[model samples]
Target: MEKKAVYPGSFDPFTNGHMDIVRKASAIFDRVYIVMAVNSEKRRAFDCRRMQEAMERALADSGIRNCEVSIYDGLIAEYTKHHGIGYMVRGLRNNMDYNYEENIAEVNKLIDPSLEYVYFRADNVAVSSSMVKELRHYGQDVSSYVPPAIAALLADGNTER
Candidate 1:
């Protein structure tokens, strides 16, 4: 079976930390789907289209051709089963995230036994989507945290790519 994984997140702004996970996952999986999950419980600063566009541009610029961006609604396990993907990639910024992801992983495992979660810890947890968003909100340049293409978008005072 082809080794494919789903990296699901809101991705309000695709950060370099996200790129790092994609780059790493590319080495192992034949394909990585950067899934933009629209969970009603979480709030987002940017819409899915803008996030998808930024991701597409970043992927092209970063030369990560093994991955593709797609939007999905409902449980990720269901999405994975529907798409025939067996692995899910998740990024953890800290122990707090791990605590949360661990429970989610258990739930997902129960939902689909074939589905597995691959967790990658960010090397620079200080530079996360929340941090970038907070910095940008204060009119600060977040070019170092996210991809250059995305940083340009934030620098432009909007999420246009």
Candidate 2:
């Protein structure tokens, strides 16, 4: 059977940290679904289609061939289950996010004991999606924090909100 995993997130504009996790996960799983969470509280300027497009462009340049991008609404556990994904991939930047993710992981496990939670540590604690958004908001250069294609998308003024 092919190993499948889901990495769900807002991915407003694929950050370096997000790309890092996807790249690593793609190597381990036969197929990695780069799922964009449509119901996230953090509203994005771009819609689901745009987010997926930005992610695809970024992943393509990063050499992650075994991954596909899509959008999902509602609970991540349900989405994973429906897609036949036994594992959900998450990334951590620091200890601060551990508690929150751990709680969510527990709930997901309760929902389906067969569902596995895989966590990857960010390459650098300073690199994060929030930081990238802040930089873009302030008109600062965030090209280093995101893939070139994502940088181009952001530079094109798509995420003005």
Candidate 3:
């Protein structure tokens, strides 16, 4: 059986930090799914289709051939089980992220006991989706924080500059 892992996140603008984790996971797993999570309660900067498309382009441009981009509306744990993925990839920047992800991992464990987690420390601890969006909101250049495709997408609607 192929070792497949799913990396789920809002990925509002698939940041460099996210790419770093995917790179790490792809190196270990036979396949890595970059899942764009849909949360109804949260207002998204971009739609799922757009996010997935941009991520696909980014992954391709980065020459990450073993990773696929997908969108998931339901629980990620369910998505992994339904797709026969046995691993999940997560990125940690600090203690706060550790606490938050730890709680979510526990819940996912209850839903799928066989699912395992692989964590990668952030390559750049200061980078995050929220920070990228905020910088774009102010018309600041965000090319360094995100992949080329995502940076272009975020630059499209940024009218401040």
Candidate 4:
């Protein structure tokens, strides 16, 4: 059986940390689906399509061939179960992230008992979507934190690329 894993997240702007996880996960899983979760309750900084395009470009540039990027609007647990994907991947930077992710994992398990969670520690603990946004807001270069495509999007300042 082919090993498939789902890495679901908001990915407001795909950061280098996210790229790191994708690079590593693609190595082990036969297929790694980078699912972008769309939550109505949360406000996002960038358009979903634009973010997805940027991510796709970055992933392509990195030569990660075993991954696909898609947008889904619902609970990831339900998405995984409905798609028959058993494993889900997450990235953790610190204790706070672990605690929060663990809580989500528990809830996901309740929703789909067959679902399993895999966690990867981020290469740079300081990289986060919020930090990227803040730095960009201050007119600081965030190229080091986010992927090149994402950095271009951020530097463009809401203009379509």
Candidate 5:
């Protein structure tokens, strides 16, 4: 019985903040699945394939072998159960993030009560997918927030100096 945990999100750009949470989780769980959640309900900036690639590149570049990236479309609890993972990792950046995650946790508990949720605060400055998207929209460099591979993609699109 291996200990596996999931870290699911859109990960529009795999930011360093996101990597920090994965790093913390990997220490605890034998395997950390960085699921790039593909929720059809939400109209996000990037697609699942791109997000998955960014996460993979980021993880490989960081030399993180205990973690892997996957794509999920349905409910997250279902995904966790299907993969036999009992833990889920989330980065609580602020009070709002806590509240939102708490609410989601309650719902997920109803679906799979055996599942556990692990929370970690941002190791560095707080970074969110939405903030990264906003920064890129303004053609700003997001090297500090996102990984090198993602930074290259963002830089290619940015027109502002």
Candidate 6:
């Protein structure tokens, strides 16, 4: 039997920190699914298709095997239940993130106690998708914070910069 985990995120623009969590999760699980959550509250510069393509390209460039990417448009716990994913992988950059994610984890636990939440501390605190997006919006160089493929996608987008 293979152990599968889901790493759900908006991933508007995949960042290096996100990749770090993916890589770490990949090592711990037989399969790691990088799920792009569709949230109306958060708008993305690239559509789902483009985001998936960029993520695939970045993962390939990084030589991260045993990982898959897909889009989910509902509650993460429900999606995980339907997909037979037992674990939810998350990345934490700071205490603020922990406070936010902890609340979500608690709610998800209440909804499904079988669901396990796994946290990964980001290797770098400053390399976040939000920061990358902000840098792009300000026309600052964000290549260092994201993979080349994602950086190019962000650079080409008019809304981001």
**Index of the highest-TM-score prediction:** 4
Compared with the true structure, what per-residue lDDT tens digits does model 5 show for residues 6-102? 9998777678889899889988889999888877787766656766776788788888899989887889999988888899899987889899999
Better of 2 and 4 by lDDT: 4
Worst 10 residues of 4 by lDDT: 152-161
Candidate 3 C-alpha error for residue 50, in Å: 1.7
- lDDT by residue (tens digit), candidate 6, 1-161: 88989999988788888999999999999999899999978777667878788899999998998999999888989888888889999999899999999999999888778999999999988876777767777888888888898877776644341
- lDDT, candidate 5, residue 130? 77
RMSD of each: 1.8, 1.5, 2.3, 1.6, 2.9, 1.8
lDDT of 2 by residue, 1-161 (tens): 99999998888767888888988899899999888887656777655676678788888777778999988788888888788999989899878778889999999888777899889988867887788878777888989998887877777754554
The local lDDT score (0 to 100) that residue 97 gets in candidate 2 is: 76
In terms of lDDT, model 5 sits at 0.83
TM-score, cand. 2: 0.92
State in Å the error of residue 160, model 1: 8.5
Better of 1 and 3 by lDDT: 3
On residues 15-96, what C-alpha lDDT tens digit does candidate 4 reach at each position? 9999999988999899999999998898888888989989999999888999999999989988888888889999999999
Model 1 lDDT per residue over 7-48, tens place: 998787889888888888988999999899988888778767
Score candidate 4 by lDDT: 0.89
Task: Note the Cα lDDT for every prediction shown.
Answer: 0.86, 0.83, 0.88, 0.89, 0.83, 0.86
TM-score of each: 0.93, 0.92, 0.94, 0.95, 0.91, 0.92
Candidate 6 residue pairs in backbone clash:
none
Query: For residue 45, what is the lDDT in candidate 5?
Result: 65
lDDT of 5 at 77: 95
Question: For model 1, what is the alpha-carbon lDDT of residue 27?
Answer: 84
Model 2 misplacement above 4 A? none
Number of residue pairs clashing in candidate 3, backbone atoms closer than 3 angstroms, sequence gap of 3 or more or interchain: 0
Clashing pairs in 2: none
